[model samples]
Target: MEPMRGGWAEEAALAHLLAQGYRLLGRNRRTPFGEVDLLLEKDGVYVVVEVKQRRTGRFGTPLEAITPRKVARLLACARHLLGRDDLPVRLEAVLVHGTPEAFRLEHLPLEV
Candidate 1:
């Protein structure tokens, strides 16, 4: 497998989200547990996002890559970033797939 450029996918996801009216809060927010790919706010609600991308479906869709263990880690990281575990914040996954010239982005909200 070729090395994937995560930054490229992340940038695509960020631009897609922004165009959809989400306000950016942070990107690549790190914690001991994991990193939140994108943290956003809209309509006074916070969203913690995970971005997954693939150059092709020869393996699987980007959404298929998100395992339960990853979700747990993402939840923990989001909690750490917010300094609480009970926030009503929502979790979302952004899937970016395809080639650079014809990339496709999909948002799966309420992931957690």
Candidate 2:
């Protein structure tokens, strides 16, 4: 997919997370295994988030784009970056759709 106009849906998702008290620790964090769109923490629990955007819903909901391969990659990325901070972790996805002027946002927390 093409890059979003201002960063990606990740930016909007990140902003939303921050507003909801999630601390921002990383953005676009990448490793040889995979890339994490947003890394956050809430009450010491780590969160790995995927932000997906679509201009149309012809294919499916934005969340439907996450394949098992993508989930595996996200899990690997989180594990690779876990280091010594063995905090509880949660995987999540953020969906953004519609025109920039009139968009919708939804959050989906996933089980890793």
Candidate 3:
């Protein structure tokens, strides 16, 4: 993806999450295993969200960027976040792209 397009997607996601009453806990949170794009909190539950951005349809849908290997990496990152105790939480994917004023948001709830 183009760097500029990717930036827009990230900004759009931040705005979307904020509008949805999700508190931003952290951004680009990295662990020994991998990195989480956004760590959010809502109603006392944690949400580990992976963000994928695509400007065009050349490769496929933006969500398709997430593969089995990516899922494993995300899971490992989640485990790192839960090092001490079990956290009431879920994994999610946010696909964002398009014009700044007309961005699209896709939320995919991941089943653990």
Candidate 4:
């Protein structure tokens, strides 16, 4: 995706999360493992949100874009940032479908 469009998707995802009472802790945080799209906190639980956007399903759905390797890297990055493996960390996904002006966003909790 284009950087500008990706930025728009991230912003939309952030807005959606904020509306649901999730506090933003960080965005585009880089670690040795990988970059985390969004880090948020809600009810004492830390969340690592991976934002994905797709114009169409010709290739695959937005959620399908998250590979297992990507999840591993994100988890490792989150652990490194939090400085502990025992902390309660939740993996989530923000799936954006269609263009920035007309899109459907879905937030789903992921377990892996």
**TM-score versus the correct structure, for each prediction:** 0.88, 0.87, 0.84, 0.94
lDDT digits (tens) for residues 1-112 of candidate 1 = 7755788888888888899899999988889998888999977778889998888899998988998888888888888998986776888998988867788888887455
Query: Model 4: per-residue lDDT, tens digit, 1-112?
Result: 5466589999999999999999999999999998999999999999999999999999999989899988989899999999999999999999999987899998998777
lDDT of 2 by residue, 1-112 (tens): 9885647567778889999999988988998898899999988888999988887899897888898889888888888888744757889998899766778899988765
Rank by TM-score, highest first. 4, 1, 2, 3
TM-score of 1: 0.88
Off by over 4 Å in 2: 1-8
When summed lDDT is taken over every stretch of 10 residues in candidate 4, the lowest stretch is: 1-10
lDDT of 2 at 95: 88
The predictions' CA RMSDs to the true structure, in order, are: 2.8, 2.6, 2.8, 1.9
Candidate 4 RMSD computed on C-alpha atoms after optimal superposition onto the true structure: 1.9
For each candidate, what is the lDDT? 0.85, 0.84, 0.80, 0.94
| Model 3 ranges with Cα > 4 A deviation | 1-5, 99-102
Error of 2 at 87 (Å): 3.1
Query: Least lDDT summed over 10 consecutive residues: which range in candidate 2?
Result: 3-12
Candidate 3 local lDDT, 47-106, one digit each (tens): 888889876677798878888788888878877876744777778888975556666789
